[model samples]
Target chain A: MTTPPTTVPSTDIEVRGLTKSFGGFLAVDDLSFRVEPGRITGFLGPNGSGKTTTLRMLLGLIRPTAGQGLIGGRRYAELPAPLTTVGAALEATNFHPGRSGRDHLRVLAGTHGIPDSRVDAMLELVGIPAAARKRAGGYSMGMRQRLGLAAALLGDPRVLILDEPSNGLDPEGIRWLRGLLRHLAGEGRTILVSSHLLGEVEQTVDDVVIIANGHLVRQGTIEQLHGDPATLVRAADPAHLAEALHGQGITAEPATEHGPGALRALTGDMVRIGDVALVAGVAVHELRPLRTDLERLFLELTEAPAHRNRNLTGDATPSTSTEEQA
Target chain B: MTALIRTELRKYATTRLAWGMALAMFLLGAIFSGGFGALYVYGSLTPDGTPVSEVVPPLVLARLVYTAGIQVAYLLALIIGVLSIGQEFRHKTISGTFLATPRRGRVVAAKVVALVVVGALNGVVHLLGCLLGGGVLLALSDLPVFPEPAELGRTLLLVLLVLALWALIGFGVGVLIPNQVAALSIAVAAAWIVEPLLGFGLTFLDGAEWLAKYFPSQATTATLDLFTGVDPEFARTLGGAEDPLAWWTAALVLLGYAAVMTVVGWLLTRSRDIA
Candidate 1:
């Protein structure tokens, strides 16, 4: 990984109205998103939110009931050299218990005429060189995760789709993986990493495609999703501030959760709140737009009732439907 | 195709299951061949107070000795085939396998080729055990140990083919039943328990001979029926049909079974979701 990044063909991932239903239950419903090359897009969803199903469909391990899960404008099965184009590590347990870690990679490497040296190199790259000879059955969860990662990277694939890649990683291992993913994505690779936890990938992904109950909740950059126009205004007199904001056609409610004398504007421009405060003679000590908690928003978007959830329209308001459901 | 086959072969080689099964094949081959050979030779010796070679021709006796273990050895081959595909499903590694090679037909073809090679190796090991154990007993019985070299060569070739075909049948069974325990149970029970009883009934029961020869086990016996060369009368007494299938036809029948199993297995595996 330290060597200069090898030039790899840029590939984008596209899911076009993909839908999958098992028996009568829909797992993925008309989900669509684009993951561009050279960026890490977190495929964020809660457990059983169809993230794994979507990824498996993209890799052609599972067939979509309708629409398509494509890589670089083609189905995964149509790729001339699929391993070289898109490498996926679906689960850590997708291994024979008796096979050694190194042998597992060698088995896959042989299919593509990949050299054994590359297998060893991938083991080293994943920081599992010492455990390469050990049977996978005996591997710790972190080691198995590393081995799965090694197998995924063995082909030097341009695109990597990993499902819960950091499920068993420790803090240190997670950090190491973050660095490694950053390095690989830096090489213009299209990396779609699925996770049940958003905080796990919030700092790591450039863009995110969030789904809940087989429906797309949101898809955008972390910055855009974080650009929640709700402003946090702290004044000496919270009642006066609320009144001034109400007169300016912006609803401001006392936000005791943040702090006393702080008013949270439901949705308004920052300049309008400041101007309203200045004109009304309200002592405005602090006025700044609140940086929305993406984690909480992710939980809210995913946990909220699907029918009433207005997340699809990118509404900044934190839906209170989940609180009602709770 | 060659690379896929090579990769499949590597997968079987990496597991301890294959080696353990191979060891079982050799031991079973040796014990059955040597024990049966010694029993026939010594039993005849004790009854007549004379060498058994005078009663049974050396070529027929040698064929009996070499092939005594194969009845049991072929079961191991079938098990090998079953486990080859069964292990993948049981371990849930089939997803990764399909991911690497999306063309399911190619994967099945490679597995068949690899299973054949493994079956051949098991055949060789079983033959080695037969020669080591049966060869010594034949020599000690005051018989020509290498009786009819050309016939012996044909028998060895048939042994490999029979084992390989059995492995294919096992592969088919594995594919038809992805549950390892259930597949192994039904395959072994059918081959070991039920088929043998049906075979016995076919031999002794009235008006049953026509349907008997088509059974996979019966076809296997007919394919390797070398006794007709040295002693046709005695071979018939041992259950040779009044109008038995030609060795090649019997071989074709066994192959037919393998093909049916493989095609069905391939079809189920091709479109079935790996997850």
Candidate 2:
């Protein structure tokens, strides 16, 4: 037999026209995205926007109804040893209650022929050595999540697919996890971290693949997607400011109302907002470009009525390519 | 495969349920053997109230071994089966299990092998307990000491067969029902109530004798036949079949049930989403 491919050199994950359905409902519809190696890739979406489904399909836990998800250049199931290729924490706490935390790791390690010494090392790595001997049934949700992480790290996997890893963590724990993911990515590991909370992923992830209602909405580096200052503007007397800007053929909507006269504007041109304010003889108290946060960017990209309607009425038909959506 | 099996055994061996089942088997065996030995000793006395030949200690020990092997030891096998598979789903540990070993078929196979090992260990423990308990009782009651090697060997073999069946049945229930309490309840109820009741009701029917022999408990009796030194008549009565199945035939039938159940469970496990 030919030797199996050991390393996925590109560290790039490319998914094309991946679709999955449950009964008659489309969970993921023509989803296409990529996660480049050496950077944290945030799989961002709303609560039911198919983020978890896409991740599960990527891990080969649930087969895609149509299309393909590739880690490197091959599907996840085709990998010789998946544990060593990809480490995942899909659900924070899926463990046998009767087993101690250390024993749980030991059993999982045995699957890939990993030794018991590695199990102890992982327990220490996740900082749960004290509770390692205690039965998993009595562990708190956070402790179980840690143990799950320890198991994921067993094979020294290059790709990490985590779903809401910070769900039940304290502030310190969340900080620790963020740092850990960053450290892993720094080692050239491809990390696909999913979270509905954009604020949490904003600083952690370097790139993003945003989905809404099971469809790809926006995907790029964090700087490219959210760092563009050309579309946002802030000013005083925002209502009059918007009206004057519209008169000048420059559309400006309310970003957020701050005080009596202060308001933020989400427009196609920040430069145009300043010019329109000057031409309309309106005093500009605060004329700065609005920095787009992930949450705001996500809402703007996904809240379009046309997109929402398409998602709601679309049939559960699977698509073979991303172009099918177009 | 050995590693997987060993891991599964470790998982079940550490549980309180395993300990409780073993304790129950030892106690039940001791009580039954002690009671029978006492009665036998009393009945052996002459009309003058002087004792003649006494019941052998090893014989009473063998009886205890047989009863516990059939009843208590077998029950532990069922418990092992249910806990092995059912606990994974019941405690939501299946996700971890699947994540670790994505090949679902291998995991199911490991559980079966583990079940067999557990059954064997329980049988050995029960036998030792019987021998020791019987020896103590005989010494206390001043009974004859005759430990027949053939009888002991037979009793041990019967215990192994019965325990194997119990584990197979328990595993089937665990895989089909995914809930520990529900699986245990169903296995216990079927062994105690449903099969026994159906067997009794079938005895009144004509031409159903052969069919009744296929019932789980009846099949267990047939499997247990390898252990006893009793005559063919005694074996026939215990099985309660007009034409009882051969020991090997009973083993095959039980194996067939286990094989089918395991395959079906594997299929379900493979196809269903772990969510």
Candidate 3:
């Protein structure tokens, strides 16, 4: 807040050690990240992982217990014209059911002195015009989200913050929304969208800030997470194989259901892991080169180790080879 | 600020709930004024031994029927205020509102000023209702059917003042109590149950009779009483014993309640996070 907008106009959003707490429990703990201009940065987390809380703080809906959430380097309260500078749809149902979609946007536009023409344009932009005259209560979940987005865009703001924007959207609606976000970012408008799963936004967002248990667990470009392909192999003694592979300076992750019933290691070359397994006298029941999918990588990075263990072991069998052998 | 007011006005106009509540207010005013005002005021006697049936000094009939209209106007104003302001919180639209108008204080001011206009609308409709009710009953009684324009205008001005204040009170209550249903319930219960009970209970409490004059509803009535005396039965329900305060004094007291609530509510909104 001490910094002026002039200092960070290109950096649309900045969260520096932002923390929030209820009376006893901390909801968001020391989270920090910057949303660069002209990119869709996914704010990914679990249901209670503080994505919404952080977005709320950034929009000035909730006060941060520590640090700051700044837009254009100014606190939201200090943004002389917040509506025109930042348009945020924090939730899908933040509207009156009694009002029409058009009326809803018009009332909001009135607050910022936005013209009526823009309301109509936004209605067309969000593609809810057919339902624009109907009461919002009658809107389907996808329609409500479209209206929410329409309301956010009323001011033609430079930055858009959407929390769980695709919650109730069908695949088609979600595809339409992805196109919208990509188009907005293409025009150099910064967009920050939150979802509980990275796959939900991996195609839409260029960068990612991932959180878990109210803390930043991982963050980087989608390429950074997905570029490093790995290897999957099932061994008769999986834990022994994991330790033996670790001796060669390769980190082995416990296997997920998609893995070939073995430890999954982050590496593109299959020969190195095969050489280590051969040295350790472990039986390689299955071995295959693997590409890291964003969703599995997200789960590996965010879920609790114990939970990840259950996740890695519950469906992981001895080996498909063992079943074939039987 | 003008845009905000327009937005609030539009919000009320577009919502079916607002129109429905307002229509109810208008009908209530009409029935109370025409049906009940006829039974209570048409044949009553004035302070100087003049019959309300007399056509001269239209004050006798104007006062009789306008007083009934004032009570109905209060209820209507309260309803308008609650619906106008309460729904923002009820529907969790306060976030949208604050987002659009980041200066929370301005939203408070806009809400108050907008409700004042709605309050005036309530006044006009209630007046029409009273004319319908009282005019019908007076005609039935063989008294003068209506007051002259000058007398009619004054009664309307008084009723408008009362209704506008009640609306502001409703807006203040809406801000202070964030729950829409709770704020509205308290508003109705205060006017219908709490004020009447307190006024009735304090009537025989020798030293505390003066406390009733300070009640918001009573203060509004007391100010109105300056132009015309209230019913002895109605007055007694409000801790009735003495003449009302000077017209201006009662006006100031009633206004003080509205000013305090509005200003206090504004301060709270300023400090608290909307979430």
Tens-place lDDT digits, model 3, residues B122-205: 677767767777777777776666556776676568778878888877777877888888888898898889987998799789
The top-ranked prediction according to TM-score is: 1
lDDT of 2 by residue, A216-248 (tens): 888888888755343444454568777986787
Which of candidates 1 and 3 is the stronger one according to lDDT? Answer: 1
Task: Tell me the docking grade of candidate 2.
Answer: acceptable
- Cα deviation of A252 in candidate 2 (Å)? 10
- Predicted model with the maximum DockQ: 1
C-alpha DockQ of every model: 0.79, 0.43, 0.63
Q: Which of the two candidates, 1 or 2, achieves a greater lDDT against the reference?
A: 1
Residue by residue across A1-326, what tens digits does model 3's lDDT show?
Answer: 11122222354799999999877778788999989888999999877777888888887778889989988889998988888889889777877898998998888988888888888888888887789999998888899899999888887778989989998999999999998888777767889999988878988988999988678887888878777677777888889989987888888877656445567787877898889889999988888876555676677676645223221235322222111121
lDDT of 3: 0.76
Clashing pairs in 3: B34-B133, B34-B134
- For chain B alone, what TM-score does every candidate structure achieve against the true structure? 0.93, 0.81, 0.86
- The true-structure Cα RMSD of candidate 3 reads 6.7
Give i-RMS (Å) per prediction. 0.7, 2.1, 1.4
Best by lDDT: 1
